[model samples]
Target chain A: MKTTPEQSEQRDGTATGPGAGLGTRERIVRATARLMQRQGYEGTGIKQISREAEATLGSVYHFFPGGKQELATEAIRHGDREFAEMLRRALESRPDPAEAVLAVAKDVAAELRASDWLDGCPVTATSLGTAAHAPDIRLAASEAFERWRGLVRDKLLACGFGAQDALELAHTVINTLEGAEFTAQVARDEEPLLIAGRHLARLIDSYR
Target chain B: MKTTPEQSEQRDGTATGPGAGLGTRERIVRATARLMQRQGYEGTGIKQISREAEATLGSVYHFFPGGKQELATEAIRHGDREFAEMLRRALESRPDPAEAVLAVAKDVAAELRASDWLDGCPVTATSLGTAAHAPDIRLAASEAFERWRGLVRDKLLACGFGAQDALELAHTVINTLEGAEFTAQVARDEEPLLIAGRHLARLIDSYR
Candidate 1:
């Protein structure tokens, strides 16, 4: 079933279920993620999130209770899970590990292009912004990265790479995709993504 | 001649110079670069830059009249040059490209650990933050990435790889370093860096 905005908001705690209720909580988190993706955590504001979500300040406080940091934590968690699932599906699409890895890179490239290069790994900007300011958020972001890395490592190991080699390859592949995304986003082009994908394929081929 | 902090500030714009005062304009650029490496552009404020450099906000404005955007542009330029020079020097320190690449990775690991895992590629975090918020900064970051890629490609090409292969390898190496840093920073461990360095060395060897 297609989830309406209202449904999503209600499910995620943004709005009161039923009439005259604004889903303040869910809307705030979604808006926070969107703003952070575009302008970064420090650059985004609670007021903007409230306005974007079409909710009042009182509603935001009612849901989050902890303000911006709480809202950001929830948003980052949501983004992390969404991205991890996306990556896993991308990786599992192909039986061959090398093919799967390249496919994931291509998928990310397409996603970025579709967003007009405005969107990228959601945690990237937040990870940087919160690194020095909020260690708790940083730890949450770190856990998200590890989960993704674990997925890649498992896939490569299943493809016959030794444990050590598999782990290293996974690390390299994940980072390459990330670094390439950052570069491609900045360049507003897909060349870096494509180039990084090809290199990752080569590395996998060498292992085989 | 040893320059006092006051003399250095007068000459370079920063209270302490990384080396000689390249000049007031260059000093502001270099200080911004160093600060970005540690704290990212978003987290590092213009006021902090001015205070750290012992320059008036007006002096900073006078040098980078466009404000933060202009300062970032100059910093990206300086970072690109510095990274290229450093990479070239590391590569030249050994005749074998594979060995040189490994040496450079090891050196990066050492530096990262020494900084208590607090440092990373300024371009990585800065690019992530600016790509969505500022198009001009995005372009500048892209240019810097391209320079680094070109340098790596040149080294790989000299090692007997085809043009396409060289470019791919370059992207992979750069990505590995960057991705590892991201993970390491979050995990607060040096293992990612060390492992990535060894893995890159092995990847290079496989080509031979």
Candidate 2:
């Protein structure tokens, strides 16, 4: 679910520069990311990925020799990279740390709504379902989680919390958002996210 | 993976009522819960469930005539029941609310480790992955979540928080635990649970 290129290029409408905006490899990965984010690894198939990416089956095999496992792992890693950047942009813009945390939750909820709940955390289902069989995917997911946690901790530290306190708060931030996203998607309502935001805001404020 | 019949029977070795101790139907459901809890919906197969449950294919078909979907939805629903009971018991024994919360997290973490991380929220991955394909399972999961949340809110209220505040706190408590369990399993460690336990304890104490 880590769509590596978070910028969401226009998909290079014209075939003039096939490799310019998003080449064959990029398309396959992006398509995999999108599908995996929604339906997860087991729910998605290689042919579907090839079709969605608009890449020829031959090209998909060419780009990913190991096929779905390789393709999904790469897709997840790509999503991991892009999401970390998205989180940074969402959180860094707000000057106040506590406010920034709440903003991050709400902003992510908006993103979920924008994607029609198709994109929660690329890693949630994708990792849990696939990790037992694919160690590489598990490692990628774990790394992505650590990256997100580190960012949240740093933000809290900047906001004047002690290191231990910041670490704990950081965990709370990610944990609530992750669970909230799952519930929101299941219920097909954004209320869970908003509730999470309000409760998280109170939790953050209680730091005083 | 709702484990119904949550009174925690000792697995009646020599059933006074034959098929009561580890009955074929119950075994199939329990096996499905374990497999689905770890591997999720699409990742688990009926044959595997049959083998794991030590039941014949005919018996499996007899128990779950509708096959995988039927068995899985039943499994998740069963897990929901069992988990609600587990949550109730975990949260009920302690007199001090904050300490109870911490103890619940720790006890569950211990349980997760005992199962080698195979026993996370029974419906977590199962519900998220199948809710789109099966609405009944989704409803069961939502109902189970609300039931659990109500229990937690009641606990918080008993601990002296206002009704509104208790509701929000209950949501946070569940949210954090769900996400932390996912992370801890993926990372193959219990630190996330302990981290969540501490943060949740502090959050609970803030109300006082």
Candidate 3:
């Protein structure tokens, strides 16, 4: 049997689905995340996700009876948590919290360049596309943000900052990082992110 | 003749267009802005814009020979500038720069609540929808961010900060505020923005 180009790409699992080894259901979720990261929620198509996941359209419905909205909600929640964990692990490589943040920022910068600026946290992007009708997706995105904030807050707590200051600084870092990502993508440059990283490092140092 | 609901809405021009007194061409632009603000670039339909604007479908093509993309580009540019002006005027009503920022944040929070969270910075939302394929729209959004950043920089310079620090602080404030707005929308609360405002005010105070 001959495979089409999109099917061949899916068979290789390269263009999308970093976790191609996952089950069919999870593969669909990953593919949804990858597509949404680039084209955003409305821009991403279900047919594309089905092809990318190497699953039939029926499988998508089987896994998510609520259709694209359900898949999108899962993708947002999964992508955000997975990205935050990767950031956390990479950040742990440095001994100092400030340096760790700088290091993580550098890592994300490299990833952005590698992805040709196609990748971003899709939670807010998805929320923008669905906020009118899907309250559950909005709430899921909010939880994802809170979880990411906790990552920063935990690092500060470990760095010996008090809870109050840690919480405040966490908000600052998360807000700055997310904003920089948007600016960086639009500008087609990573300098905004690098500058944000430096500023966060300085901010953390001040608290230290 | 008595008007139907949608016709009444179009005549009043209040369900969407903030500028109810606008001419037909301008009304089309304003209606596009309002729908795009709620549903994003891909989600907003040109027919809907025409209906909301009370303009004929023929007029849409007449104004935008370039079609939906062209209309979208115009809508984003006009909406962002108009919204910024309103924010600027209101922000200027306060005496001090810090107070002005806080006031602006408060005003946006109120607006968000009133709009049922349908309103956001349409420039960023539109860019996300167009980022993968449309370079023109992305550049428009980048310019819009620059314009907004200038708003903060001007205030900082007036508040006696050095030119370099003013620019940096201005970036910080814009990035944080944009990011906070996203977070607030997802959370369905204004606390993120309020916290961001207070932090920005403190940063400005330190420079002062």
For candidate 2 chain A, the 10 contiguous residues with the lowest summed lDDT are: A11-20
Give lDDT tens digits, candidate 1, residues B77-188: 7777877888889987887877787788778777777877777787765556676557787788778777877888888888788897787678768777777777777778
Predicted complex 2: CAPRI docking category: medium
Could you tell me the lDDT of residue A55 within candidate 1? 73
Clashing residue pairs for model 1: A14-A23, A14-A24, A14-A25, A14-A26, A15-A23
Per-residue lDDT tens digits for candidate 1, residues A1-208, read 1234343444344344222243445667778888887777777788888777767788789788987778777777878888899989988889988888888889999999999988887787766747666787788888888788899999988878899888877777877788788777887888878877877887788887
DockQ values per model: 0.56, 0.55, 0.61
**Model 2 C-alpha lDDT per residue in residues B149-171, reported as the tens digit of each score:** 89999998887889987987787
Regions of candidate 1 where Cα sits further than 4 Å from its true position: A1-23, B1-23
Question: Mind giving the per-residue lDDT tens digits that candidate 3 earns over A1-208?
Answer: 1223223444454435465445677778988988887777888899999988878898889889999889989999887888788878966777688888888777777887777887866777776767888888888888888988898888889878999988988887787788888888888788778877877887778776
Q: In candidate 3, what are the lDDT values of residues B100-205, reduced to their tens digit?
A: 8877778777887777777877887777857878888888888888888788788778777899888887777777788888887878788888887887776666
Model 3, runs deviating above 4 Å: A1-21, B1-20
Candidate 1's C-alpha lDDT?
A: 0.76
Find the candidate with the highest DockQ and give its number: 3
**A66, model 1: CA deviation in Å?**
2.8
Model 3 misses residue A25 by how many Å? 2.0
lDDT (Cα atoms) of all candidates against the true structure: 0.76, 0.79, 0.78
